[model samples]
Target: MSPPKETNNKINTAKSSDGTIVKAGPIVKREKVILHIDGDAFFVGVEIAKNPKLRGLPVVTGEERGIVSALSYEAKALGITRGMPIFRVKREFPKVKILPGDYHSYVEYSTKMFDIVRRYVDDVEEYSIDECFGELTGLDKPLGMSYRQIAERIKKEVNEELDLSVSIGLAPTKVLAKVASNWVKPNGLTVIESALAVDFLQKVPIKKIWGIGPRTAELLNRKDIMTAKDFYDKDIAWIKLILSKPYETIWQELHGISVMEIDSAPKTVYSSVQKTRSFHPSTNDKTFLWSQLSKHIEDSCRKARHFNLVPRKFSIFLKTKDFEFVTALILLPSPSNSPEILLPLAHAHFENIHKKGVLYRTTGVTLLDLMADFVPQDDLFGSNAQASKFETIHKQIDLLEEKFGKIVIYLGSTKNAIDHKAQDGGTDSEDLDKNLLFL
Candidate 1:
């Protein structure tokens, strides 16, 4: 990428009430253009997309987990916040609608949304399920449209195709693009030209800046730096003296210099794979808890197998009704991603951690110290042969799952978790039927 271009023109100048000239800063000419696209109330939006009648209603997801995961703008207006207990919402806002989360549908919509942007820009970063950053520099001529026009086209395509609203920001840097995208909400399109960036920054609180958190905002506020413009006006040397490298990068971005590059590569490696599920109504049933943990093992192993990775060690934990965690870490005899090997070990260790009469609300498993799965050399004990056989069986099972649906064929231990309706986002028979329609 070329270095960000700057000009000496002093733009955003204004006359104060006393007729004095107020200069915000020099105009930093646009050298790079980046677009940030974010969905409007993503989870709730997906639910509304699947069923249009749910729109214009106070809706929230996470009914299965007994807490709010995402809420519609209508729900937010009614003082319903994310992570708030569902029982309270029902008691306080009885008119509000609570629905179970359907992550399968969310992932499908996310893929389609980002794919729409990828049609326009090759360098698109899938920042999250509902957000992405695309590099739009130098595409105006080939596309026969301005950067803003290209952004508009992408946004229009996503909205029309997915029946979803996305807010887009066009700016010279990622941070500014993020700010511009959030400037207006739901279905908004805002452009922060390099010359006008300072004008926008003047109104944005320091805490609202992309990477700055509440603690950092408090620290900056101690020094009376309350707005993005305030921080941007400070001396570069002073910023370096007080803040860390990340903040310095933000400052450079605030100066219309693109310090962060768009990362578009797909993730293939992981340090660990963790799967957790919280269910409603804590249970002391050992079979249910084991089934939940077994399901987690299968899910985590499936992910590891997708990346051709094996874990050298793994851990399991159970969350009690009081929110206390009882965890145990186990080292494997060999690195493997097959749940056949993990389930038995987890069952044996379950006894050590399971306290009788303890009501648990969550079960989790983490596969750790992962490395590439390589063919093992033959051993005298024939354990390698057994593992290879299980691997082949799992490969066939994966094919079956791809053809049918996830968990169509799972271990007997996981049957209770799948058959039971009280966990994994509280997906019951009715929710399953609705989800099948989306597929």
Candidate 2:
């Protein structure tokens, strides 16, 4: 059978050690276990860990209009929430002190944590600069106690080596492990024993299952399915009928396999991004369409900061209901990460796209011709001023975003035209405004 496509977002179910099909609970990375190590309060955690003085204070990271992008568990309990506008966040819990996140620090600690995981597990996938998913293959040597032993070993090393805590979830499949990892926060390792998966999966809300976020879960709930078991009992067509392409992957992974191809080679890290979500389907108002494009480009730039390379070219992809496809790319004089520059180009691309006079079902903005922060010597201009300018401002804005949270800061004047801004007024500088910000 072609690898069974994931049909749901719930991954808590798996075949047990005794050959019984059930839900996962207190999962430990067995021979087949996938240990997903997810950072809790990542940016906030790192800052607190770096400086002892930051501990236990309701620390919000970001700048003006910067909401809580990542809240420490301590902060979360105080009723502070992610995406709550910083202004509102303060109003809700006025006593909390906010600190901007440190990107370089996050990357540094993330590297150290993964280093420990590599010593024990042969397979490691650095899913992001902050999180990792690792496979502990060939654990048969430790006999009956290997999974629990390694899980504990990983936890101990992280505590001793980095002084940082991570939540670990273990299961037979990547999806379950990812969900399990999140079950415990800050410092926790939860294992979903194969036989107990059914009970565990049923108790957790569908949204808690990872792939199904609030929006998808609401849709699932409308269909009267609220738990992993509901999705499990759901037929293939039921899944297809109710879920989108993304949720399909969740369902298959719940069964201990995934449609995703896993290999040692890490997937290409996107240096640029373009995302467009269809509005109420009217697609008629050009102004609304333009806003979406602007939002798309600005969102990509936020993530561009994480990739470490600036982009010099912007590419546009437009799709029409007629299934017509059009793509165009523009190369700038220098690499850039500012929406102000890219949005104008995106508008120009859309203007070209509009010439066909067909309603668009999709639109995308891509940054291409990516290069190092400093461009190499050019024949036309021996000492390029533009490249130097792009680098300085890029770093500055990145610093501001890292500190302020999301799109709270913008290039020159684009700060006024912001979407995805949290109640604190911080906007998503990254793609999750469109993709995971894809993970």
Candidate 3:
């Protein structure tokens, strides 16, 4: 006989090292363990990590032009929300500490955080810049510690070494682990074993379950399935009738079945890639604006090359100081990731869309309609040959930059863009010619 289709079913199982193969009555459904660790107030924490004095103070980062990107817990407590304009924040909370974002340092700390996680478990997934997933299965024996103990140790090490708090969750599946990790905030750890899964899930609202977005949650709510427990209580056949593969996978995951495995590989493909930068005090200079757009285009091209992708189309945009926005789109002559070819085309469209005397604060470039890098087709203008030559030169430039620094070599048009005036009244440049780091 099979387990009950309409209720919380329990089956008697013959326990094995692998945790499957049930015997015949009530048993705990066990599955592989996953641990998810997420940084607390990541950008703000990075700033605090650099200056310990910023700790316990209300901190916010962003708005070289005018919007808040991130806020510390203290600032959040004071009702300072992200995306809120800094001028409003100044008026409401004058004591709030505002700083410009340091993406370079943030990347450094992100690498350190992942490296620390890798020390504990080799199968670590850098889920995001400030989050990671570590497979905890089979790590118990080699480490000589229980899964929860290992998680706690990882948490402690991160705090002691990075001086940043992390919220960690350990559970049978990635979805559940994410839920557990988010259940508590800012230095909390929650472990959900198979036996405790249902009880814990029962308390969570249907909308709170990972992977179930608002539309799906609303659909489930209409059916009176309002809690994780309500979704879990449905039989397999009933779930199959209502949802497709991904939601079905989430259902199985909730039932202690590891349908999704940990993926350690970095993402290789992107539908679109975008790069944007905000300028301080805004500018109406056409040359400076084009230079900023060129910088963004080059940055986007570099990212595409990293993923071995080429875009068939490109979109460029300018955001004016008065919040007016203008955009232009172009179909590439052929799929390409070379800024040398793309930037000139971008300039052609920028001239058409850019209105004179508009104080623009931000410029952005987006590469779209991407596909795997492929050989370009011959065109009427026969730019293929010139494109190939530019491609070869860019490869050499890429190598030099990789060895020396990202800004070692640059196109003349983007030279002014390279030495960007910092929002905080400083000049931020990555010119290794000025200073080099031995490490």
Evaluated against the true structure, the overall lDDT of model 1 is: 0.86
- Model 2 off-target regions past 4 Å? 1-31, 140-145, 258-263, 267-271, 274-365, 368-439
**lDDT (tens digit, per residue) of candidate 1 on 114-197:** 999988899999999999999998788699986767887888898889999888888889999999889878787777766678
Against the true structure, whose TM-score is highest? 1
TM-score sort, best first? 1, 3, 2
After superposition, which runs of candidate 1 have C-alpha atoms over 4 Å from their true positions?
1-30, 218-225, 230-245, 283-287, 322-326, 347-359, 380-382, 422-439
Q: Each model's number of backbone clashes?
A: 0, 34, 3
Ranking by lDDT: 1, 3, 2
lDDT of 3 by residue, 114-172 (tens): 88888889888888899999998768869998776787788888888999888888888
Candidate 3 ranges beyond 4 A from true positions: 1-30, 63-65, 218-225, 234-245, 267-271, 277-293, 306-308, 315-333, 344-364, 369-382, 399-439
Evaluate model 2: give its TM-score: 0.61
Between candidates 1 and 2, the one scoring higher on TM-score is 1
Best prediction by lDDT: 1
> Local error of candidate 3 at 318, Å?
6.8
